[model samples]
Target: MIRDKSFYKFFVILVISLAFQNLLVYGVNLADNLMLGAYSEKALSGSALCNQIQFLLQMLVVGAGEGAVVLGSQYWGKKDLKPIPHIIGVTLRFGVGIAAILFVIVFVAPTQVLGILTNDQIVIAEGVKYLRIICFTYIIFTTTNILTASLRAVGIVAIGYLVSAATLCINICLNTCLIFGNFGFPELGIEGAAYATLVSRCVELLIVIFYLKYREHQLNLTLKKLLFIDTSYVKDYIRVSLPVLLNQAQWGIAQMIQTAILGHLGAAAIAANSIAVIVFQVISVAAYGAASAAGITVGKTIGENNIEKLHEIVHTLQIIFLGIGIISGTLIFLVSSPILEVYHISAEAKVLAKQFMCVLAVTTVGTAYQMACDNGIIRGGGDTSFSMKMNLISMWGIIVPLSAIAAFVIKTPPVVVFALLKSDQIYKILPVVIHLRKWNWVKKVTRAEI
Candidate 1:
């Protein structure tokens, strides 16, 4: 129903850029998965387990950055640029501290940590080898993500995809040469994959720095600005950001738990789950991009006090989200078989993976709609606590417990347990729809002066 041409233009640009950027980021992981899968099934399983830790770190760092974006976008809306640097500073301090802590833990107890995910000694050993090298990229990745998020809050999204493209290319080429020992290079196997990712992280950081220093003019950010944050904004930042942090952390931990449940099933289950997840992650980029764009748009809209257009915007976005969900689901369903064929896993693993993807294909529709609505519209409007509460209830209270019971007690099929784990995407729709109608999620997070 929305008729504004400029709105469509802005939304389209942001969605395409952010989606491509996300695609490239996942493309790096896809490269790792593909290369490792070809090397050996053991190598792929081990690296997949190690990547779970990386995924957890990503969630935490992204949670921190998103908190800043929520605030920064509002400030950017008012054309008030002074407080944003402080917001970035607050974000960096928390983000880096988290990265450092995780690095120490991972470096200190690589085997013990991987043990929590699966009991397979072979898989754990492979994971440990990959973890030792890949863990080093944590801090570097965090810094780049937070910086990129700062740009995104102000509607500058092209840099993110561009940097990711460079990283993807570097990762793929290195993975090819190092993983296979091609062109006289020493074959590092799983170790080579870890090294390739580590190098890509460093290069990604450099690219982000170059762009910030030379290309970006709005914030004119300096090392000084990052080092000396206004302490006054710390409390405000925590107040708005803590819930989001906890939400993401809990969500990340929940995913690990899900992995652990499936990991206990067998190596085939672990390998299958990993393959299915990568495909879903790649194809769902558009859905995620829509959520990110929605957050920025809704946050900026509230900051501008353009409440009049809010209803139209939300309605129109819902339609777009539904369409995106259908297309994403179809793509996942169509590509599931061909993608499975590329993996050098057992036939049993391939069959299980296909089943998982089928489940994801159906759940993705609910995910696209509910994720965009909750994350983009509600949380983006400054009601961060809602999602925190909703996730706690749905994930912990319902999905996790039921899935655990199904997987362990009832001895359900792996596919059934996975469906239970993802059922939140569907059941949450009613509550989210009800809450959106109430309109209480709209709150201006910006202050008169910092």
Candidate 2:
């Protein structure tokens, strides 16, 4: 315990910092949801659907950043920060490329994508308008995410928190003007939300560029590095990132499948489930923040060849995540109803959300273990394959199948389907928790060229 104190301290501070970051990011969407609901219920529903599609687009950026964490943390740990800038450049380029692809898909084919989520003509029409308007912003937002993530990987936590808070304020202000046509602005309603988001993202991208050019010290991302791709570094980046990319993609696909299944049940189920998820995500960000810091800390230890200390840090982080689980879970359980009340859904949806939130509350510990092991330990050590395998098995092997069977085959309601889905966390817990005890996560993984 004494030896682990520093690790816990680091995790606690990281979690607190990241919690605010998550609040800023997710808080914007939540506030948008509430504001839209207050002004127009139909607009809120349309925006919710568009938000789901946006989440899917953002996943690619997330995958790329996660890969960067694996490489950046280990390299930074080894005291080789020279390659850090190149890594950032490479990751940002990939983010931009993916964002471009998603933009075309969402803009040129908004109806096609929106159709996949739902068949409601009203929802799809509104979603299409929102998607087409916001798709162009993805390139900017995704690029910002990679740069911001890389910055955090190298101990620049305060910047992300500060920038995100500022972004949130800017977004809200824009939302007020655009959403209600204040001060000579046109009233766009749901489209206003998309416009506000795009403006905020542009601001975020500008801030990132300013820091990267003058204020930043991590990378020297010139046009040559950004455009003239080094084949070797690109190959290695793909090689190291493949497993992580697959892991995130597969997990995302499974989640969409779950959502599809719930969609078939009806709109109320979908809305309630969605609300519960976003709220749960708010708390889960705490665990993710701990995992982020732990991954960097452990990767640095491995790069420096401090195997014993790496082992100690892993153990310490796992414990801290567990404690967070207990506290976050208890808090969610106590506040589930009040939180659900914020949504403008029907009484049935409210009750279902409460039940869903309750089940999720209990499973927070399992989530902590998986995140710490998979993100903080395995991927931190650049052991991406095992992390991929664990997630694939937990998501595909356990969660999706079981939930499908329970919900569709057994004719279960939203409550039971949610319980089945939450069971995935429990399955992921045992194997990862056991693996954490082995202390095999002490290895260096980085090319000198980086």
Would you list the clashing residue pairs of candidate 1? none
**All candidates: TM-score:** 0.99, 0.92
Model 1: per-residue Cα lDDT over 1-450, one tens digit each: 789899999999999999999999999999999989989989999999998999999999878998898999999888898999999999999999999999999999999999999999999999999999999999999999999988899998999999999999999999999999998899999999999999999999999989988999999888999999889899889988999999999999999999999999889999998999999999999999999999999999988889989889999999999999999999999999999878899988999999999999999999999989998999888999888899999888998899989999999999999899889999888989999999999988899763
lDDT (Cα atoms) of all candidates against the true structure:
0.93, 0.74
Using lDDT, give the best candidate's number: 1
Give the least accurate 10-residue stretch of model 1, judged by summed lDDT: 441-450
Per-residue C-alpha lDDT of model 2 across residues 58-121, encoded as one tens digit per residue: 6667778877777777777777876666676778777788778777777787887767766567
